[model samples]
Target: MTDTITEFDSILEALHQAIEKSDSAAAIRTLQQADHDQTAKLIDRLSVEDRQALFGLLTPEQGAEVLERVYYFQGADIIEELSAQVAAPFVAELDSDDRADLMNELDQADSEAILEELDEDLAHETRRFMAYPDGTAGAIMYSEFVSFQADMTVEEILNDIQTNRKKYIEFGVQYAYVLGREHQLLGVLPVRNLLFASRSQQASEIMIPKPTTVHADDTIEQLEDIFEEHNYLGLPVINKDGCLIGIIDRESTTEALQEAATEDLLKFQGLMGKEELRSMPLKVRSGRRLSWLSINVVLNLISASVIAMHQDTLEAVIALAVFLPIISDMSGCSGNQAVAVSMRELSLELISPKEFRRVFFKESSVGLINGACLGLLIGSLAWLWKGNAMLGLVVGTALALNTTVAVCVGGLVPLALKACRQDPALASGPILTTVTDMCGFMLILGLASLCLPYLV
Candidate 1:
């Protein structure tokens, strides 16, 4: 056999032997080095006769951890590879979130089969989440949480916890929700409060009513803001009928924040939404990127058209052409700075109509100060290089004007977009660069044309 095949086969053999010997550490090491095929081979080897049988040999936690490691598709393959009897405990071993995620990934037939194998309650909850559009808070929340009747005494709840101390692992309750007789959510009491409360105290007395909640349909961004605002470890997700369906915990919130941040970053660069990029093939990625690139090329052509109008002046005074880059550079840099600041403010919801006057003044002041310093530097450099004081003066004036324009465009455009219900970060990248270039080129060259007679 060739060296590559020999190495691969040897690794597979070693991995199989390790698993057969119940050598967890050795199996882990082998898996760490295995390619997709080899990794699948290991799972397939253990699951050859009956996939669910593999779960019987591993602890629930270990099985859950291993399932997470495999690609979602591979996990599904393993599930199908197992018989119905074996798949039951394996599915039960997964936490609510993981189970929901897996169910959503499975085909309807497989999902129904698996659901039938699960406990009735767990099966129903998983199906509930699978019903939500992917990425919404409902799809991501955990159905397991601590809930107490409104009239339950603190002592009663404490006694229950003592009786069912092991239940916490399965329910994964970080905080307890207070509910009325019909299971309508009334308030929330943190774990800390419950522990500190008098045994005689009722849950209703200690719980905070009107606790923050998000509807199941709330977007991830909305959920993120609620979490940040409330300083919550998790927030309850309720249906329109005011029924508590699930809870969005801190872990899910963090994941949502990461995905939201990624989307914003991609949108800032004018890319398609994150979902498009995540599941798309390389060729699809290229096609989407090329489409945007072509649009930007048209914008660039507009900028070039503006520059071409001033070419006669540029040729007559080659020094002006040399000075052009300096002005454009300053404007683009200053505009980008303003755009970044504006986006930060917008993201934090720190800006509003009431703050508009102050924000504009602040941005304008920054622009003026930036323009003055950059204008002086570029003007002095041009004078020294071309040995023409008049050329320097004209270039400096144009630099200052262009810089001011660039800063204003950067700030105002984002604000305008926000006012029209558009994302401000979308105002960055090619759009910002193109605007600054067109404005800078016009200001500098137009001034140079007017000042050419005086200078030469």
Candidate 2:
């Protein structure tokens, strides 16, 4: 096809025709003709089979370009589908951090096989990067940066940068760092200084001594705070021995945050192992979904048992049945809002698990206000429909009380779960739902039973 891929949708038919014909040349030509953004979107939307088919047609250089642009996990999936032999060359073209990311996401067998196929130095470096605990600065830091010994003359460093233009360009010259023999960071030389400094001066003589550094094992939260406070484009990362190893840039930290957010959203949806995709194995998709659905059945049954316990009150006042779900659902919505706020605060480190009293008081104040407002509205509705003041009061009071209970449970349960080191997102929704249902049922039915004489 001579047609250029301007829009992703326009290119799909050509790709399908090429794939169906099993023409690798046509497939690749079609891919090459497509716009870069369209190609990436096309890749993302393809089924696993189509993705593999299309990727298989790409040259190693082309494949590497594809791998680096897609999200890391998404790239890992592509690598996992390819043969270790076919994947390693493309992997070799990636920078150290990106290489480590793809390798880390591979299955053990796949990773080992791919590693074996890679250059010895590259393989070893990949393993070293993988050894960093996930969510630490080391795990996501860029291994590309320009560094020189403190003794190198400005002329010599400038000459070296010019000679290895491609290498330095990839390294992203922000500020040149000076290191000791052991590679301990000694100083930083702002790139602009080279314009004014004497060419004969040694790096240490002109460099700003003892520039800021972060340890490789530092947490991402620490990195976020550092970057936010300083507004620096990048910071040098060192090992426990204080030798420079990598660079932690604003881009890396922001990407880590985005990945964490995606993982949390999945966890909140009850996806086990914190990830799931339709393209994943059918068994994996089924099992992850069933895990939550199965527990939900048990929870729903428990709420039903509460209804069974109050069978007499429900029978006596048939109108109460209409409001049971309304109350539970409305309160559950309020409670989930509290849960969301608590989760956000915890993630931002604004609050800790031990601050139960603080969360309780804040949630209770809102709950009382919202509950009273909601109660009045529902109370008015009940009175108009049923033409009875006592019935309206009973229904309205139950909803109001249940709303308060719901908000408290929603806000507190997340903190309690955090204290126990459990996932608040996974447990909070079900906990809030079940508690609100049982409480709403008890309040309405229990109050109605007490005031039975007046109603009759």
Candidate 3:
């Protein structure tokens, strides 16, 4: 370990001392001395057996503070490891939103035990969150937030905050929402804004207008887009009736999005992600990967069949056979170039109907130019090696033509797929390779057959 590691270890040692001494105030003070990651490490270093003991040393409220400071998964791990009977009361003590997230990761028996331990209203709210799809805003949002009538004066809101500050702090309230008498969302006010507002101002006067709101059903992808666009720390969630339901903070969104994106990326590459693979046995992981590999094998076989069809032509002109790989390779490169550009454009939404024709023409031009240059270079090599000018010319011409065709096909196919509501990126690798292989084989061999007499 280096200086940083040594420092962190010392901090952990200090924390352990505090824990052993049953100094709750000292532990909280120790937390202030270290950074967030250091605090997380201290929490993680304590075994599951030590969690309740550690908590028992602190007040219920101080335990809540420590729990909030640790990583969510680390807290969940401790909760899961505790006997359900022992853990239930602990779970009941968590803020509603944190409880929901922790419960979701627990075994069914433990989850049910915790639910039974919760007050009726908290249990119902926690169940509502668990019912949402895992990757949606609803599932990630915290039910605990500050809300007050829009008509209320700032002084009134201040009084309410003073009354509920301790409860809100324990609940992890980051921002307060403004709602109508019927609980319809009107706007949002960050705690800073609330603290700075004039006492005489109405909540509506101080609250931000038309604040970004998320529907309960919005996907993690949609939430990511919104967060990226607005650079938000948090956003509110509402039901169909426009009633405030919950608020999704940056932490939850970040966690959910990282998992969701990893899953999507792994799926695109034909693999199960770390998220899905983490809990799985090695045998199961292998089985999942093997299925995708089998599909790739089928694709390769199709390319092989195309090669098998031209065996006779290959045999007659061994020189041509030697150069076939060059043709296919050139075409494949050109196709991949087109696929990459198209995918990037589509993903960024840079490709539009108005620009479609321009993009197609540009890619086709690029294909033709690249194909001709590569063809000239390869044809020259074939002529020098084989001592047959016609053979070289045929290979060169075929390469040039096929490259152009491959690129055009590569660009067009993905765009067409996108227009038809399919993902364009999916059209790039395997499908593009297949098209390039077939075209290259047919073009080179077909040219070879036509030029056979001249070579002989």
Residue pairs of candidate 1 with colliding backbone atoms = 51-82
- The alpha-carbon lDDT assigned to residue 356 of candidate 1 equals 60
Off by over 4 Å in 1: 1-141, 152-167, 187-232, 237-245, 250-255, 275-280, 352-361
**All candidates: CA RMSD in angstroms?**
7.6, 3.2, 6.5
Candidate models: Cα lDDT each: 0.75, 0.85, 0.77
| Stretches of candidate 3 exceeding 4 Å from the true structure | 1-141, 153-156, 170-174, 197-202, 212-231, 249-261, 273-280, 316-330, 333-366, 373-394, 401-428, 454-456
- TM-score order of candidates, top first: 2, 1, 3
Model 3: per-residue Cα lDDT at residue 62: 59
- Model 2 global lDDT (CA atoms, 0 to 1): 0.85
lDDT of 1 by residue, 254-292 (tens): 776675577678777777533342333578578777777
Candidate 3 collision pairs:
none
lDDT of each residue in 1-456, candidate 2, tens digit only: 334534555677788888778788878777776666666666766888888877677777777877877767778888888898988898988888888888888899999999999989888888999889877889998777888899999899989999999878877778888999998989888988866899999998999987889988787888898888997999889878878899888998988988887887877777876366565678878988898989989988998898898898788888888998999999999999999999988877789999999999999999999999999999889999989999889988998998998998899999999999998877888888889988988898889889987665
TM-score of 2: 0.89
| TM-score of model 1 vs. true structure | 0.67
Predicted structure with the largest TM-score when compared to the true one = 2
Give Cα distance to truth, residue 385, candidate 2, Å. 3.1
